[model samples]
Target: MRIVLWSTAIVVLVVLVGVVYEQVGRYRAARDFPAPGKMVDIGGRKIQLDCRGSGSPTVVFEAGLSVDGSLSWSAVQSKVAAHTRACSYSRAGLMWSDASDAPYSARQVAQDLHEALTRAGEHGPFVLVGQSLGGLYATSFTKYFGAEVAGLVLVDPSHPDQVARVAAFMTETRSLRSRIAVWLAWSGLLRAAAPSLLPQAPNQTARDSQAVHAFAPKSMVTQLVESDATDASLAEAGAFRNLGNRPLVVLTSMAPYTEAELRGMKITPEQGKQVQAIWEKLHEDMATWSSRSTHRLLPNAGHDIQFDDPAAVIDAVMSVVETVRADRDNGSH
Candidate 1:
């Protein structure tokens, strides 16, 4: 009985220490790294939006799942901004954005973005550049607000049917891992290990992204929420099949999964190859969504094309922007 009581007390003390550590870490992070952009109120909640440059059609960036919000576009946003108005924003519960009790779905995310842009006076004709899961959200945005969207750039985007098609990707173990990540984040263990866990890229943008992710405790929770709603989000995005004559650029990464990645997914090399084949096919199908679409395969790039090759992404965006500009000038848009 005494041993049980002592064990309980020790656990309680450890938890208290963890909570205090998290609080202190959070305070220091907030002090050191303030929001780098305007916090525009979207009704009850506020979202951080960083806009730069100036031109007719604004370029908006949508980040991937479990990323550092607007900071994910740090490498390419400024370069794109130089030619046209480019903006990146944090979704609710990520980075500097306020969290919401409401469920996180693609539609809700699209609505939040629309409200944010409108309230911030960042009007469109807009070109949306989405990376990974962000591509689905961009598709959802176009499904609802097609008129404002002039073009789209999907960088190794997630396919709507990936969960069903990629057997190695949607496993019970993967779901369990996501749940474990949330617990780690809540316990502040994730923050402690974040520096070592994230990629040790040499650039300042990478370091800043790492810092923001390490400090954001709710980021994991938000990621899990988004993961849970993946099916619904995919369905919502998949509903939009056609983009008419709107310029579209689908960049597919040809990098194969590494041996370690295959081991983690518990799939054989043959199975991994099959998965890649299906992925490429899906991108090809996505290219058919627009009459003026250009599907480019990057041999040296990976899923995070924005990071793997920012110049490729910039070129894609510029190409789409130029196409939109030409259409506008010809009064054919």
Candidate 2:
């Protein structure tokens, strides 16, 4: 009995040590890397906004759900910055940004972004680039501050109806997955193995990847709140109508899913086709939101068109910027 207790204690001690080591690693990574850009205060909390290049109108990039906003756009931003002033920012509770209060609804998230840009002195009229879930927030921003927006680019954006539609399809499976992910993240197990779990670039060294992974965990509290608020966020964003003929470019990816992805997401080929049909329809509707809108589909790219083919995104953004600038130059818009 005593031997068993001693063994159990040893195992517990090892596990506890591992947890502490991971927590410390994460803390150190965040402290050492520092925010690439200055943290602008949005009320009590702070948001990190990384801006590059010079020339207007300023272009702002918003990331997909649960992604490192600034890092995700590192490659694209650098390229776009060469031609025009481009900025990418972490929403509250993401990356180097501090956590904000509850109810991260679409409207609130948009407000947070507007406030961040204003506080950072990033003057507009601005061109906005949004990816995946970032699409909702981007649209909401335009709705609230339409006059400030000059152009829009959406990269394989998530339709506001997606969460509800997908939820109805795989509620239980998604709920289970979300629970497991959140629990693991909260327990620090995810952070402990983050180096392996996080994405690595072809040119990035292992240490660079580790540093990025260490600081990228989305806090479970924030994740849970965001998940719970999804429907409301969609509803709020859906209320907005018309884009005032803003120059809009929607880039879509038509990459076929691999067997692994299909199985992992619990989607069959038929369901995938159905989803794609709905997705394309939504994109078509979004194009109609503006008279000066175009939708392009890339057969080879995946959902992350920015990463899969940064050139495509860059081209689309530059096109929109040029159009907007021309309008401004001619005093037409």
Candidate 3:
């Protein structure tokens, strides 16, 4: 009787405490997150831009999925901004960019970005740098917004059509299983029992998300996670569903995990070969994609080439800058 009541009260108290903790964690995650930098009104939408540096053939970085604005472009933005007015922006509904009723497609994003560049008085043939999902946007710019682009550097770019051909093997095996495992690990029961600890070192000294964006390069894993550009229920399908014609540099992840990654993904060797062959074809298509497209491999790069290898990205953009300068000079004649 008395003992049962005490135990019941204790259980209720524990549940209440857990609820409070979970809410606190969520609130912190939301609050600690920083708004993107420098809002520019482009085509009636509030777009965030980090436009630093100076000079022409302005180097622009289009971020991978989920990331927008300064944080999205951190890795390569500053390095390029040092030499030219490099622009990195948050797409609509991402980070600090205005949420739109519009679908998140390559074309729509490109149009919005076009407006931003125009509003900033940025002119055509700018060097484009994009990683993962951003590759779709960059490629679309070449096909649809050719007037503004000069050349492109695709850092581990994603292709719309070949996606099914790309990760299908992994999806068929370990990836799905790992995803399920993570789901279980982060489930309500586990989260309730999990210790209250900060993701980084726990001092309650919350990291300055803004400073992280204002400074430092993006993380390779974060970049990799930004691969899905669309919010579609189907996952892989998104706007700018194809890479029509864009100068590209496809940096592949050589992290050594295979179809036997962690889940049920048991991709066959033939499947691995197929994925490689698809990339080779994408490389070959680059010639058709641009008048002068280069495919350079980053030996130790992951999906987020910019984040993992900023110097390589810097080198690529510098190369484009040189070309843009030469072309402008030649055109002036």
Candidate 1 vs 2: which has more lDDT: 1
Location of the lowest summed lDDT over 10 successive residues in candidate 2:
165-174
Candidate 1 regions with alpha-carbon error over 4 angstroms:
168-170, 173-178, 201-206
Cα lDDT, model 2, residue 43: 77
What's model 3's overall lDDT?
0.59
Candidate that scores best on lDDT: 1
lDDT of 2 by residue, 148-254 (tens): 99989989987767666665344333466556765666456667655554667643346545556766566443655676777777788888757878999998888
Q: Specify the highest-TM-score model's number.
A: 1
Candidate 1 residue lDDT tens string, 202-302: 23365586666555576667776887787788877888878888999999988888787678777888887788889899999999988999999998886
**How do these models rank on lDDT, best leading?**
1, 2, 3
In candidate 1, where is summed lDDT lowest over 10 consecutive residues? 197-206
Off by over 4 Å in 3: 1-36, 167-255, 258-274
Please give the lDDT score for candidate 1. Answer: 0.84
lDDT of each: 0.84, 0.79, 0.59
Q: What are the TM-scores, per candidate, against the unseen true structure? A: 0.94, 0.90, 0.68
